[model samples]
Target: MTEITTAQPRSLTTALDIPRPPDLSWYVQARQPVGYEVNLTRGLLNPDNPALARSVGADGYTSVRTLVVVDKVVDGLYGKALRAYFDAWRVDARWKVMPGDEDTKNLEQAVEVTAAMTEMGILRRTEKVVVVGGGVLMDVVGLAASLYRRGAPYVRVPTTLVGQVDAGVGVKTGVNHGTHKNRLGTYFAPEITLIDPEFLRTVEPRHIANGLAEIIKMALIKDASLFRLLEETVAGIDGDALADCGPAMGEVVSRAIAGMLDELEPNLWEWVLERSVDYGHTFSPSLELRADPPLLHGEAVAVDMAVCVALAVGRGLLSQADAERALGLMVAARLPIAHPVFTPELLEVGLADAVKHRDGLQRLPLTNGIGDCVFVNDVTGDELRRALEFVHAYAGTRDGVRDGS
Candidate 1:
């Protein structure tokens, strides 16, 4: 056996007994003027038009180059015209087409798009990456652009009702992870969001309703006038009405976009906890991810908003009559007011998850009344359970009416 010798470790300790002036500690405040324009236009993809070029400051580049990531659906609908437009403008463009379904919107897709941008030698400072598609495409491509070289400027051209009025106007770039919706994402504002309501012409009726769900969310949370507009004009919000630029449909899109921007501008990074925009988001994330034959993003949001309406009513924050009116409006617009997957147990799980996201408290946004919102950190589990039950029952009653049963 080798002799084991232990060497004692000497500790060097010093105490500052003498008074020393504290190193001047102060925060360096920075006010970065970060803003993006939401350009509502028609015929943005037309070669003769300069909307796309001017929005991106294309002339600023010695050689105007664009890297476009398009949803396969959008490409199939308008890719030839878009390519021709780019050629006619003498804009150097590299196009990559991929399906933009929820299943395909993930970190893997982000990585793939980032790789393609790299291959195209994307100039992070000058060349713009234009994303054209619906919400999924916007999210995945935005994530890719945000991750490449820490952030490369990009433009959004949302080609769906939901995209234009809701997803496209905001700065959130995200992709689903495992069972969580928007689990991996960053808040990256686009250089510009070109919203052509004309895109809605190509969208399905159900998709139009999907977008209306978000419009309803904004109306319920922040703008009473917008809510009234939605209620009064719900009948004229179908696909054909939107394609024809009907006044009702036009107002819905414009007001929804404006209302959302109003809510987002003040708290771009969400340092503020009292966010009205979070009204439909907290509960919907889980419901959207867990549903079998999964729900559309706005569909899940509509259901969650119904649950919130119930919660508000139960708390005496919103009148029962107002709750009914809100639900009726959702019904009139053909949005889902309740979903079968929203069980009490799932509500508990979803709230728990939301609490984690909201930083250890349930910063749940409930309507003080329609068009006004307040956050509650002390929402009891019992209240949530009751809200779930009320929504389920109310939805059933509405369904019975619809079926004439």
Candidate 2:
């Protein structure tokens, strides 16, 4: 009889004697402050130079355990020197050599790197994985480090021009997934990035052009003075000249690095999608993954830039003369302005993918003028076709003259 009586439950509002909001949820806020150094020096591997040794931070320990991942080609060229430097600094460095090519930039390669780190028994906090190579290897190893034990510290020693100026400076690490470029990736910052232009001396000429394309992209969208410098020295600029570390080429490297960091530091995670640094990237991913012989990343970007230049002209965002000047600079730098695989259909597909990547709108970056950019949401297939046509025609004319009838 006593247990038969039921008690009424009190309302949440009445229990607390306060009004309850319509939504029932708790909000959490956090911030991850990212900071890293990009050090530029000559002779980074020189046993006498303390830059690389200092970066390794092996002061107290008899031998600090470190995993050093290097490009196969770079290892072939500089393996002895690297060994000597490590020995001189009394650092226990485990070497992992990987192919630093576009084809090797994939999830499997990243897994291989992670496996290497596992085999080395990488100490998560104390040890660092040092990647020495071009952009592709840097990306793969960065991705690997980001994945291993949730996240591991790593250093970047970019041996190629592209790695030195563009990819090496950024916090984005990715490997190509399926046919998509950088489909699986994470924004992981390295402990430090070491840049030594002396390494560019061994880079092939075509690869040099690859790096120039990215530099040109930065110049077009951010620094008119950088563009003027490139324009003035386009004819003489090559891997050899850059390796010489002359003033003009020196300025180009510094300015490109400065411009890229300026753009990247503010938008580390790309919280804002309308990135001016995305100028030639909208369509280049598809073109890069689809090309038959496999165009270099920068070559694909060069072609994509050519198309964007044409589109900019059509939209009156950039003058025809400036567009021509841009295209001519690409040509002078020995970069391809067009590729057979970059068809209108591919452009449409790439734009669709870009729209999704940019979050529902085109957000297509166009060069408003030299050193300035504007983003647009509306870009039709017709406009893309027209831009492709103009690029093709321009390439044809340039080829014809170069071929001398």
Candidate 3:
């Protein structure tokens, strides 16, 4: 973990088990759905979608480097969006293909890729880079765009379920080290985000479940309606299920997008940054870091949320029943509460890494109840170890270990 400094939120705090609702009495959910004007249109391989070009015109972008994946099925669709958007727009546009996964986003990889693209004369100062893909593509391109000549405008066209609902749209950018996830990163906002749910048809169900975890986390933090929807609508998201078939799916997704709009408006620099919104994720990167090959980003976060909920129970912050019920829904939705094979040793390391990566929090805002949480930064190291051990054992991921001897 890089010895990063931790910043405390403007809030009250208490003992480990005492969760409290945020003081949002003065805050109201915005009227226009919490985001900027969105043109979520549908079209097939059209060369003049105009939405992209129109966004450029409105956002004042001059040069553009559109990057995407060639392997995914939706590549053709994105290619269509890009080709048409580029041809119709008067702004300078370049297309760069980025490699996938943690490796490509590494500092060296980002340095090399950006330089090569520049050598090819595809990037410039007058334009911003537009990234099109799932989370991995977004992070790599987001990081590159942030550093390219200091900074440039960028837009996101998230094509996967996880990308669409969670990681891609967020301006949190980073590359991972061997066992540490998102070890290097920055906070840069995208100029525009174009989310089209129709793209989910091409995504794998596991990946869809991965995205669902984050939505469920959002529900845990803010919306009970979303929690109920996940409980009723999610039966078997894996195998041969269209995960988004239920009305609950649409309801939750709409609410999330609305929340996104609230913070991402007029440039994403305000109070709604990813850290403030990503509750359980503060520990998730560490859990993934403990994995030999590391779990997928969403997968690790789902597991982390499970443990987080349980810890909330142990600390008197959340009810045991609530934790169980949430875990049950996650399991039914086919998300894992357990790692492939978790051990106390690995868990200790994960906890330390999680806390370290988060810069020795203030633990993530542990939920006292729906739309309620308390800031707790003074937990003993032993307590966190015990919490991790107990959850892992209960979920059959490890042997039962009490919360400290």
Best by TM-score: 2
What range of 10 consecutive residues in model 1 has the weakest lDDT sum?
11-20
The parts of candidate 2 lying over 4 Å away from their true place are 1-25, 400-405
Best by lDDT: 2
For model 1, the superposed segments whose C-alpha errors exceed 4 Å read 1-31, 59-63, 400-405
lDDT against true structure, model 1: 0.85
Q: Per-residue alpha-carbon lDDT of model 1 for 1-405, expressed as tens digits? A: 899999886544324344345753456988767888999887787766788877555553345788989999999999998888777677888999999999998999999999998899988888889999999999999999889999999999999888988899889999999888889999999999998777778899878888888889999988898999888888877776776776777787788888889889889988876788888888888888877777788878888888899999998999989999988988888878776677777878888998988889899999988889988888777988899778777877775112211
List, residue by residue over 86-198, the lDDT tens digit for candidate 3.
65554455555655664455777667657755764544553556666778777777787778777766677777667777776666788876656677887776777777676
Q: Clash pairs of candidate 1?
A: none
Report every candidate's CA lDDT.
0.85, 0.90, 0.62
TM-score quality measure for candidate 3: 0.74
Shift in Å, residue 104, candidate 3: 3.1
- Candidates in order: C-alpha RMSD to true structure: 8.0, 4.6, 14.8
